[model samples]
Target: MDTATHFAMGFGLAGLAYLDPVVASTPALAGAVMIGTVIGSQAPDLDGLVRLRGTAAYVRNHRGVSHSVPALFLWTGAIFVLIQAIMPQAHWFHLLSWIFLAVCLHVFVDLFNSYGTKGLYPFRDKWVALNAIFIFDPFIFAAHLVGFLLWASGVDPGRSFLLIYIIIAGYYYWRVQVQKRMTELVRQRIGKTGTYTIIPTLSWTNWTFVAKTEHHWYVGELISGEVIILDTFTIKPENERIAAAKKSFKVQSFLAFTHHVHVETKERPFGYEVKWIDLRYRSRFQGKSHYMFVAVVYLDFDLTIRDSFVGWIHRGEDQLAKKLDSNRQLS
Candidate 1:
């Protein structure tokens, strides 16, 4: 989920905390819990500061360690200690409880989205994306927004948020069913020769589908139960050129973070420009060009990496040339 949604969820949780008799009895303690909840909600994303070093560092570690199981306890304890240090008179039990819930909820809700967290880090160093929800879900955001408004208008926030959460839980359950149906449809249409990755989009009926067999790669869209093949490419995992290209640091870093990698090599005047794209994030530009999360590596005549960048880029020769030129100069 996005930052705004996480923050709103934290606030909603704080509203629901009012149902606790301990919190309702003390106004000062309730205020402390509210502040702690809001901060704990966004603290996990503090790893985003790694982008200051570079996008590659950010990509490799943003949610990698911070959203792990150990980090959940770490964030909760750290926030609890800080709040206690600032307000010694406040009730520690109520404040810490909400803070812990806020931090746990932040990591838990993130598991529902396509860009998921490495929540089981030390135990399992793998990205676990459910692909049931979009990164930015308007429905979830609006539901929380309405609850916040109602709380501000003198409505009993505890009951209102509790009811809202029940509905949100049902929404998630329905999305899971939709995702399962879509996956079954893709499996039936494509046969069982290859592995399929079905990623849900903003619309409930639309999905981005990718399949990789022993010899080919299939990229398409599933709309309203119909499978539409947008493009197909031959897979050559044993090719010398691709093998050499994967040795680049940029490709390795990208591979660490993404699941489905689509590599394309183009010969340029300087060298072979190898582009590694994460197929899970397919989006259109101007209703014509297709773009995905990409990382580009320029290898010289001897296959030495000359320059590289890891982030979004236009998927056109001219645009790529311009980006490469800019990257080279910056390097």
Candidate 2:
């Protein structure tokens, strides 16, 4: 989920806090909880600061460790302690409970999106992406906006937010059903799939799908009850050169962050270029050419990595050429 949605969710959680009699009765404690909720909601995303290091670092660690299980407890405790230190008059127990809920909510909702979290970190580093929701859902945002408007209009914030959450919960349940049906439809069409993923778009009926068989990757779109095959790629057997390229820092990090990856190796004039693409993000814009989130590694004839770029980049071939050319000029 986007930051705005997370912040709005925090705000709604604060409203739900009214259910607690202690929060309802104590004004100072209620104010502290509200403030804590808002901060806790976005604290997990503080890892966005990793972008300063580079796209590789950002991709590798953005939701990798910061959104993990241990991080969840750490963030909750840290936020509670910080808030408690500042507002000593506020009841400690209520404040801690609200802040902890806010932080947990932030991590929990992220699991539903296409770009998921490694929330189970120490236990398993595997990324858990439900692919049931878009990173930014307009409907979720609108609900929060409406709730804010109602609160601003002098409506009881707690009750209004509670009602909004009930509706949102129903919406999530419906989305899950829709996603299940979409997957079923796709599986029926593409029999004997090894890995199948249906990523939700902004529209309820429209979805993007990626399925892997033993031989090929099936990438397509399900729009208006139709499965439109966008493009397909043949799965290549891994070789020593490709294996060597995989050991590169960029490729290793990219692998850690994504699944259903399709690797393509091409021989160039100077070296070999290995492209690692995440099929889950495959898309075609305005009926133009298809694109997928990709990383590229340029290797010498001996299979030593020359240069690389990772993360959600476009035009893998063109970008690789430009990066190699730039490196050549610098050398």
Tell me the whole-model lDDT of each prediction, alpha carbons only.
0.83, 0.83
Candidate 2 local lDDT, 205-260, one digit each (tens)? 89999888889899989997788777788988899878988888878878888878
What is the TM-score (0 to 1) of candidate 1? 0.93
Cα RMSD of all models vs. native, in order, equals 2.2, 2.0
lDDT per residue for candidate 1 within 132-177, as digits (tens), equals: 8888888899999999999999998889999999999999999889
Candidate 2: residue pairs that collide: none
> TM-score of every model?
0.93, 0.94
Shift in Å, residue 168, candidate 2: 0.8
Among all windows of ten consecutive residues in candidate 2, which has the lowest summed lDDT?
A: 322-331
Candidate 1 residue 327 C-alpha distance from true site, Å:
11
Task: Tell me the spans in candidate 2 whose CA falls farther than 4 Å from its real position.
Answer: 284-292, 314-320, 326-331
Question: Model 2: how far is 57 from its true place, Å?
Answer: 1.7
Q: Model 2 Cα displacement at 171 (Å)?
A: 0.9
Model 2, 172: alpha-carbon shift in Å?
0.8
